[model samples]
Target chain A: MDLATCLKKMELVGVLAFATVDSDGAPQIRNISAIHYESDAIYFFTARGKNFCRELLEDGRVQILCYTKYKEMIRMSAKAYAVPEEEQAKWRDIIFEEQPYLANVYPGDTRSIGIIFCIDRAEVEYFNLGVNPIFRDTYTLGGGTITKKGYNITEKCIGCGKCRTKCPQRCIEEGKPYRILQNHCLHCGNCYENCPVKAIVRE
Target chain B: MDLATCLKKMELVGVLAFATVDSDGAPQIRNISAIHYESDAIYFFTARGKNFCRELLEDGRVQILCYTKYKEMIRMSAKAYAVPEEEQAKWRDIIFEEQPYLANVYPGDTRSIGIIFCIDRAEVEYFNLGVNPIFRDTYTLGGGTITKKGYNITEKCIGCGKCRTKCPQRCIEEGKPYRILQNHCLHCGNCYENCPVKAIVRE
Candidate 1:
């Protein structure tokens, strides 16, 4: 539904998937629950000795995904980096406190083997299949901005009020060359398919 | 759990993930639910125009993974290929009959927009974190073979029975050179780590 709702879904779906590319260029994925979330960032912990740790260290590019039982998927594609050395312990303490089961894997002080990584910027796709005509939307988090997407009306627009009447959201603005509001556009391509002049540019 | 149970888990999961490498070498994943499974193979359908479809078509290498609510993960890595034309209709009819919801996405004849793919040979990993000390095992299906994994005992035959006592699975066979049953060995490294003679050859 929204970024906040997606974040809540991630928490409920413990053992989210974290995927990386191995040295052989094959995709590798693992289930991880040692994760703590921020409003606009995600933090996770992994053992220093594991191959997962090596992959993250060598290439910080990673994608984290969580799919809920309600048939909703939230995926974040971001470049991850180690948490600032000065604050690793502070964050690690919070994660351990929240996910007490992690203590079973790394008992007591042995958790020192854990390293913290943060994903603070990325494009996010939230897809919900629980409803008909499955809806999907994109959001940018942290410092990331939503790239220009959806359809744009070019100068060829005759402004015959065709798109304005057909738009589901009815957010289209009337002008010599009508513009569709990027944030509110459903991107269903209804206007593009119906445009008489073929004026809409799909970005 | 066993490989049979793992397959059941994948079916119960419904929305499993299949990932492939992009041209940039980044791993891309999508939630897929149109999959049909046989004892040693898996089949699925996707629209021809999707990024997931293109990735699978271009690179046949893929990893299909499903995580259960009980903290179990099943992943199969293999080379996927387009289902032969002769069998596509048979498989498509079966999938459509079983998953009526698919008809909502592509009504009746519109289903023709889909294409079938199958993965018949794969190295499978089953991991369950619900149990103490955790449990994991590998299964090779179809043409796949269990690779030369686990440690081997060389000619250095002290025969102190240290490995025999240390093996978790007790899969080590006693002889002049204590040999490990590669098929049953967990590759846990307990024997290799404890052997004083260090005769274990790790591959």
Candidate 2:
């Protein structure tokens, strides 16, 4: 299998999971119609004045999950903002292609009909969904040479599986500082990035 | 081909490409092996203090490219940072796992290991060798929804191929305002994000 085939399969069978914070700081998750990939950014469209869009404006941070029923997943984190006008017309055509009905809604005024969000940071996790536990591959925003260092357990790791669950490498064992499997680890740092206790240290 | 198969193949075949800045603010491309991917973050181990690491601390902006010999490619933009101490030991284990010989290099004191750059912003473009064209994807930082309205072309477009080359959808047809192929558009806004002209407007 090639990267293109995997990506195409993800596109064909994968569902995108979105996480956003509300005005009150409450986290919310929703499934969206599409997730667009670009050379330097990721884009998605929604209502012009929805809460989701407002949240994005207020806080540019966001996380997107794309997974297939087969257990393949890609998790990405990024900052986002609305696309500008001169750029909207070109994007609008993209929207129309995805949802032809959108063309009728905005017709000559596609600019008023949709919004585009650009991703600032991205991390992709590719994993198998079998009982046999195949292999996993992770890709980060920078070139592949860069690695994420996890934190040491400074009496901070409360044994919460948040990091474990979020870890693409599945390296953080289920216990304290929670032992990390260096062999299988991809160094994604989800444990370090999402640690509630801030216990994990880099070196 | 399944996702696992694709990843396995990528692991054996992926080539990491690096982006550096020239004196004129133009990006330069290079290939190196020090690059490695964790689940979602890209990591590299450099001397505790180097010119590149120093520059990263100041601006945190960088780009990376990875493509297979067959031409499958993924390009990303991101901010880079050095890892703090206390977190070094754990990552030391990680370093050893990936490159066991490095273990001999930093016997007891890992502090001498220098800096590790982590990339946060990420957008990916997937292109195949002879087929599959190109597709783009982006990962957001937190979690949320994106929307927009009232966008029109501004007079800023200089018709450079930067946006076209960066466009994930490849919708921009390279004309005045670059005609967008609305049918296959994902609205990921890589065009706007990378536009040298800043001609793309959201409102």
- Tell me, by DockQ, which candidate is best: 1
- What does candidate 1's lDDT look like per residue over A1-203, in tens digits? 77777787888887777888877888877778889988888899886545677679888778778887777788888888998889999999999999988777555565665789998898888876676546678878876666454688999999897877666556579998998876555455667767899998776
Clashing pairs in 1: none
> Model 2 chain B, poorest ten-residue lDDT window?
B141-150
How do the residues B52-83 of candidate 2 rate in per-residue lDDT, one tens digit apiece?
A: 44445654555444444453444454556666
lDDT tens digits by residue: candidate 2, A47-126: 55345676678865565555554544544555567778688657656756775544433334433535777664555455
Q: Score the docking of each candidate (DockQ).
A: 0.28, 0.02
Query: Candidate 2 — which residues are off by over 4 angstroms?
Result: A1-10, A101-111, A142-203, B1-203
For candidate 2, the per-residue lDDT at B177 reads: 71
Measure candidate 2: CA RMSD: 18.8
- The TM-score leader among the candidates is 1
Query: lDDT tens string, model 1, B6-78?
Result: 7778888888877787778887777789989888888898865356666788887887788877777898888
